[model samples]
Target: MRALHIITGLGVGGAEQQLRLLLRHLPADCDVVTLTNPGAVADGLAADGVRVVHLGMGGNRDLAALPRLVRVIRAGGYDLVHTHLYRACVYGRLAARVAGVRAVVATEHSLGDSQMEGRRLTAGVRALYLASERLGSATVAVSEAVAERLKRWGVPAPRIEVVPNGIELDRFRFDRERRTRTRRRLGLPEGAFVVGGVGRLARGKRFDVLVHALARLPEDHWLLLVGGGPEEHVLRRTAHEAGVAGRVLFTGERPCAPDGSPGPDLPSLTSAMDLLASPSAEEAFGLAAVEALASGLPVLYTSCPAIEDLPAAAATDARRVRGGPEAYARAIAEVRAAGPGPRTAPPAAHHYSITRSTARLMDVYAAALAGSSPSLAPLGASPS
Candidate 1:
């Protein structure tokens, strides 16, 4: 089987990481075509020998690239086309339909109702997304929260499936030595509480909330901010204004290994933290939180419905904070007072493993090609 995977961009984010994991575990005989220009995940896919066709998309609505996308899909003779993120789902599904591909699947990674900014732009994107969802052979949601939101937006239930995101336990297994070394290398004081967060520095992610929370915490604690984005400078200014600039360490964009190689620094970065703080106002699924949990680190997140859908044990380590600076600070203090329990045993490898996620995806692909209605189980159903 030949599969074509499309994504909005190759930026380092949850959806991009999910796509990378899925591609790596797809059946060896299944030829894969990746669509995205060079970015963080691109080099990794290329190194894995996945055939990639860059559409040179400059932004979200690159209609000019649609013809090129269609040409590539037709020329590749793809049996199925799977798209990740909203932009890719809209354009890729339409292109696949135009190219006459047998199966076109899309994964909805965010809640439609949660995106309230920019009314004019949101309306246009919604129209495009609704049309694409109607035309898609199958639609997958990463969480039940996401699925329900999609249904509310008019996607028929029969066409949608809820598939929780998975992770590689082996890769994220807890490492005490690495954790110790990472903290020491970063020059953190001994016995100092460390709270780390990893995500794009953007409005959606709400990194400023974390800075405010840190400012309210005792002077003995430190906040580690990883990843980079357009909001970096603004966030830095906010931290300075809050008088917590010295307490926050902004490690601008850590480089992962090129060409699919594992970055030597990732394990230490994740393992070193006492807890993972996810202040994002919205998320389709908290991949970083899962990674932290797999490493036996706890998470403190905002009370987004999507994050609430995680298993109770996973949620137990997490305390849902409200939006304001005071609420965030109070929640952080509460979680700190109640230190995380003994590192929980990692969840089953199948639950979040790339291999399992890809296998379930293949079932959807096969159903789409067989001209049968896709079997979409309820949110949290195990793959049959």
Candidate 2:
């Protein structure tokens, strides 16, 4: 089938990274469109021989791009249009329908009780989402929590499909040799306790809390901040103020895996970390936490619905902690005291494999193509 994937931007984030992985597993003649910044992921897609079109959307209110988007959809002759992120979901769904494409699917990647596009919830935003949601055939939620949030946002339950994010398990499996090499390459101290936090260095990620947590730990404990963003300067100041600057190492934005795969070059680095901490105040799905778990690292998270959904055996090493430096420090100390547990892929990993997620997505596509209207609602109507 011919499919076109639309996203707000092809930047280094969870949704974008997940899309990259999804494309590798999906068997379709697919192309991509980035509504705004065609960041590093564009290069990675091009390397993989995927067509990527960049729409120079000046800003969020750039409505002029709508006609261009509609043209792209029509010209591609796509059997289905799949959207990711909020901006893309709204505009892409509208464009698909206007272009006469019957099947439109969207993935809700980061909606939480606290935030949307890094902003707090407002009435206007909900109305906007509710309006756009009606145009799509199916709305894919990356986790049960996300699905629940959508229902609360007034999306009908039948329209929300819980398709958990998937990971490339083999790439993340722990390796002693890789640990040695990666640590040496990254200049991480030998035998020091490394607590890693992977994701965009944004305020929402709470990396500042991590730096503070590192300060309360032993001198041997160090911090590895993977990925980068506008908050780098602020985080550096935070690390310095916390007196853990020397102990903190920042690896600026890694968009693709070292082997040039769609995902980040995090697998090799995972081997070097003693533990992984995802202290974000809100997380719909914790892709990094799952990868760390798959890599066999103990995880301490504030809110990761994805990890919570895993079975006890798979989630044995992952713990939910309150959001604070003190709490995170205590959790890290406790996990350290317990020592590193098994470094093998958990049983739950299979449930979230990219292959399985791709199969489920295809099923969603088929259902949409079959003209299965899960529910119907007038545009801009709120839930009763």
Candidate 3:
């Protein structure tokens, strides 16, 4: 039950790769810290053995990193201290309440509707995020549209707690020979129709509205573009002013796990793709349109609170397409004239599965250590 996490910069986005995939399935004994560029999800959370720490936070009013993050949360005897993004939830809930660590928790992971991470919400950032969210006891919210945008940013629907972001359903399932060896190792071609765009090529991930909807398609359509940032040369000058710069590929920042890294690992670029456009009009938990509906692909999106709060037949190959780039070029040419379908994963990717979001985050860490510190120790039943 000795958790401790705190984040702000580990790089590779999506709430720093969903906090390195929720500290690899979290069963307690976790550890992490960042607060500044620790980069590459802090080397994949120190190659998954966890225990990372950097804290050199010199940015958001460092305040000398709040007593050096309260001396690394009081020398790490931590019983619980979760946190992620938004300047590590405002200096990890005031350094876990000055390191006494009364089981804090925080995970709003990008609140939207005017933005939080992409940074455009002011009034002193909602009074410093509702004043460090009243020094945390719980805050989760990765979906129910970011728990109704954190109860309209006043934050207290009994301290908000949706907990949806998750994956690892056999690492995004689909693999017909890994879609013909990741489309002949990314050169793609043999019957290409791709169109897949994952995330973080920034500019609010509009990804230049998938490069002007891949210049209104039809040239054997191919636009990959997986993760990488400061709008990778402004989305390669918006794929050369939407002339579709050589059918735009750009696989720069890939790693949703498969690290011997040098690209190609987001389930092998969502198995060489066929369709996963996410013209991100804004999203808190679209998670590459649920890992391209768990690699079954076919996702066209314009925001996804994890598939609009899951219902319409649990992601019938996910489709929303609202506007821009001619409404994703007539919804990717009506899904390429309705050709492909059954790749698999649908019940909205087994309803967000990373082991049921690590058993609802160990029941929000045993109800935030029994509401703040009923003598610690009881976050027991998590892994299923």
User: Best TM-score goes to which candidate?
Assistant: 2
Candidate 3, residue 317: how far the Cα is off, in Å = 29
Q: Which ten residues in a row have the lowest lDDT in candidate 1?
A: 375-384
**Preferred candidate (TM-score higher): 1 or 3:** 1
Candidate 2 residue runs with Cα over 4 Å from true position: 372-384
Clashing pairs in 2: none
How large is the C-alpha RMSD of every model relative to the true structure?
A: 6.0, 3.6, 17.9
lDDT values of the candidates? 0.71, 0.87, 0.81
TM-score ranking from best candidate downward: 2, 1, 3
Candidate 2 on 1-384: residue-level lDDT in tens? 999999999988878878888898899999999999898888888888899999988887988888889888888999899999889998998888788786899999999897886867889888988999999889999999999889988999988888889998889989999999988988877788999999988888999999999999999999998998889999999999999899999988877876898767899878899999999988888888888988889889998898787667667788889869999999999988988787987776667888889999999988888875533222332112
Q: Residue 64, candidate 3: how far off, in angstroms? A: 28
* lDDT tens digits by residue: candidate 3, 1-384: 788888888877777777777777778788888888887768777877888989887899868787777777778888889888788888788777766676788988888899888889988988998888887888898888888878877887987788888878777788889789888988888998888887777788788877887788788988888877787998788788778888888888765446543113788778788888887787888877887888788898888888888788998878888889888988898988999888788888888987899899899888887784443333222111
For model 1, the stretches where C-alpha displacement exceeds 4 angstroms are 28-36, 58-64, 116-121, 257-266, 304-307, 310-314, 346-350, 372-384
Q: TM-score for each prediction? A: 0.87, 0.95, 0.33
lDDT by residue (341-383, candidate 1, tens digit) is 6765445222566667777877877777887433221112111
